[model samples]
Target: MPAPQLVWFRNDLRVADHRALAAAAAAGPVHAVFLKAEAQWAAHGVGANRLAFLERNLRALAAALGVLGIPFTVLEAPRFRDAPGTLLPWAQAQGATALHFNDEYPLNERRRDDAVARAFAQAGVAVHRYTDSVIAAPGTLKTGQGGPYTVFTPFKRRWLATLDLSSAAPLAPPDPQGPVRPLGPALEEAMTLAGAAASAVPAKLWPGGEGEAHRRLTEFLAEAALRYDSQRDFPAVTGTSTLSPYLSLGVLSPRQVLSALLAAFPDALEGSGGPSIWLSELIWREFYRHVVAAFDHVSKGEAFRPAFADLPWRQDPEGLAAWKAGRTGLPLVDAGMRELAATGWMHNRVRMAVAMFLTKNLLIDWHLGEAHFMDQLVDGDFAANNGGWQWSAATGTDAAPYFRVFNPVTQSQRFDPEGHYLRRWVPELAGLDARSIHEPWRYAGGPKAYPKPLVDLKASRERAIAHFKAHAAG
Candidate 1:
């Protein structure tokens, strides 16, 4: 009997452009398994929306693997601690001689992988780990002094300089090896943990499959890439790529994205325009991953800047609840939150505005907003969510300057100037003109159904700045 190699699928769900799966398939006959870590995800605050997206992607993945003559099994472990014990028996039973998987950079994920690697080693099953998620894995680049660059600019420079597009091109899916017997019953219980299948985001908006991911990328580049830089800030324009959910769930690889970009704009790496600007966004994603891997505290729920960790956060449950429920009465903030509630996603520009209101305007804890986003966003990944919240709150590495708080009204007026986004999400204010929609309270016949501003914006902004200044002085 051939000693079949097992491809342990985690976040990297798709077979196309998959490093581990390709390598394993090239080696010999291959088997694949996805372990559902329910308790672990719950502890990590995995929300219904994200769970539903992941489940859909997994089903798509299983079907993809089935066509390639690889049996795809779904295993269950209540927690990361139970993973090795739960998975090893299955691997041994399948006549597995080796295991392959991709790396996830978070601290807990690293520890879990370490534990699993140890168990596999003791069982004489070789384990191989590939860095497939990010363009560059953490710890690969450094500053002149040999430390990780804390800022994004220098890191991006180094990233662009070091990248070799030829070598980084995406791999083709494995050749079909004829039909194989199906694995056991599909694991539905673990897939629908938060009942995320019932999400308000139109199910049609996201169709799970590698083919669908590529289709979205092609559509975005063809239609929106040229205007991405100018229109990305405006929530009303669909200028941004909605490929984040696919990227987060590993239905698409960064290499695949880069390849497509290079094909569309050959000079993109050295030129400036929509393609370059969008590429920078990808680099930012890389930067956050590097931050989490290089600085462990960010993963531990502590502020990147230690001084800000002790900064007083107001315990205003009412205000916090209002923000979460999209009743803050600030149009931009409310729209973003409502969009998040209605769909498992929000536009990036509005995400910044909403986070700033929660952390600075209301002076609520950044952790609260961070957890809420993780629980709500379909594309929520720890590095991006934590980095974004901390950046908005001015508490993380390379964060916004303490004094540069975002004004919700300004954000609304600037981004949704026509009130298109705001009106769509906050329908009660739909009657107001574009100019007045941003600040409905000031309108002659304000939306009576809408609540008043939760707190005076200017007063709250000043309070937050003063609080930070006082901490610095102390």
Candidate 2:
């Protein structure tokens, strides 16, 4: 019998289109290991909702691996520092001669992988890493000056021009090694030790597994892709594909998504309508991931653009608390926060509104809002969350201009015109008419249960702009 090759599962958990898993299976008999570094994740502000989602996906990965005759083990590392010590002995015990894994680009994860590589080298075990998480890996796209592209538009142009279809095509799942294997007890024990619990998000809201991910993708492409540009901003309508959780956790691959999209709409890349816009959104995801890899400061919680770093963010704890509790009294912002609290997800349009409300309107620090989202969001990916909050705060690459503040009332009137989205989340204002629901403060005999607007929107916007201007001048 040939020596086994151990496949280390990280963010990329699915069986199909998994380069590391395919490589491992081809090398020899494959075994899989997932290091449960829950403590490290918790320290990084990862909340119960995301951890629960991860646990569910881990279980799904184990089941899928079992069908391919690969034994899956869950090891309780608790921290990245413990990973090498925990995994080395397991590999030696299983007589595994090589280890395979897809690369994770965040600073801490990169350091951890490097340490594991060094340890494996000393132990005479080969370590093979593959890029499975992104369509274009970081450092692959560069400017004419031979540096990483900071701006998005030029980077996107290069990405589209330089994309090699042959290499970007998704890999098929590896052939089964032998008969199916029964899952061992380590997985359950590791889950318990890692403190996996019931998620705040409902299971029906986000079903685990690759099959569920693909089903959603197919349905979204078939039904909504064409109208995505038209309906995506409306919170009440299911215009956007609710596949972020799957994409964040790697339950589905970008290649699979792209292939499916092209199969449905051949001119997806070139068209001026919905398909192209949706593709731009996907490119935005890649751009953030690349940003994380290229710029170390963003991953370290520093602003991408240094000019706005010292914009004198306020320390309004009361305002921050209200924002978190979804009682900021601004209907749209409050609704968005409430939606996040209830489902561990919020509409992208509302995410911007709430973030801008916190940072610009209330004068609270963007860091507070960023941490709050990381602690509440089920689809909380560090790169995306960090990139988004910074963008709203006008402190990131291709950020909203400092003078630009999203008027929550105007936004509510435009997007949730009939108040369907507002009423669904903020039931206290349900009886108010569409016009009044947006700005109940202006109407007489408004709901007494709903609080007044937290701040004068116009005054706050002017204040934020003045502050940024003064800071820039100084």
Off by over 4 Å in 2: 193-195
Superposition error at 389 for model 2 (Å): 0.7
Q: For model 2, how does the per-residue alpha-carbon lDDT over 343-370 read when each residue is reduced to its tens digit?
A: 9999999999999999899888899999
Would you estimate the TM-scores of all the predictions?
A: 0.97, 0.98
lDDT of 1: 0.89
lDDT, candidate 1, 1-474, per-residue tens: 688989999998899999999999999988888888878888999888888788788878877887898877777787999989988999999889999999988899888999999999999999999989998878999999999988888999999999977778999999987784453454444344455655667667778889999999999999999888898999988999999999988999999999999999888899889999999999999899898888888889999998888998999999999999999989899899999998889999999999999988888999999999999999999999999999999998789987899998998887788999999999999889988999988877478899999999999999999988898678
Please report, as a residue range, the 10-residue window in candidate 1 with the lowest summed lDDT: 183-192
Q: Tell me the alpha-carbon RMSD of every candidate.
A: 1.5, 1.2
lDDT of 2 at 448: 94
Q: Which candidate number would show the highest TM-score if scored against the true structure?
A: 2
Candidate 2 collision pairs = none
Q: Enumerate clash totals for all models, in the order shown.
A: 0, 0
The 0-to-1 C-alpha lDDT of every candidate, in the order given, reads 0.89, 0.89
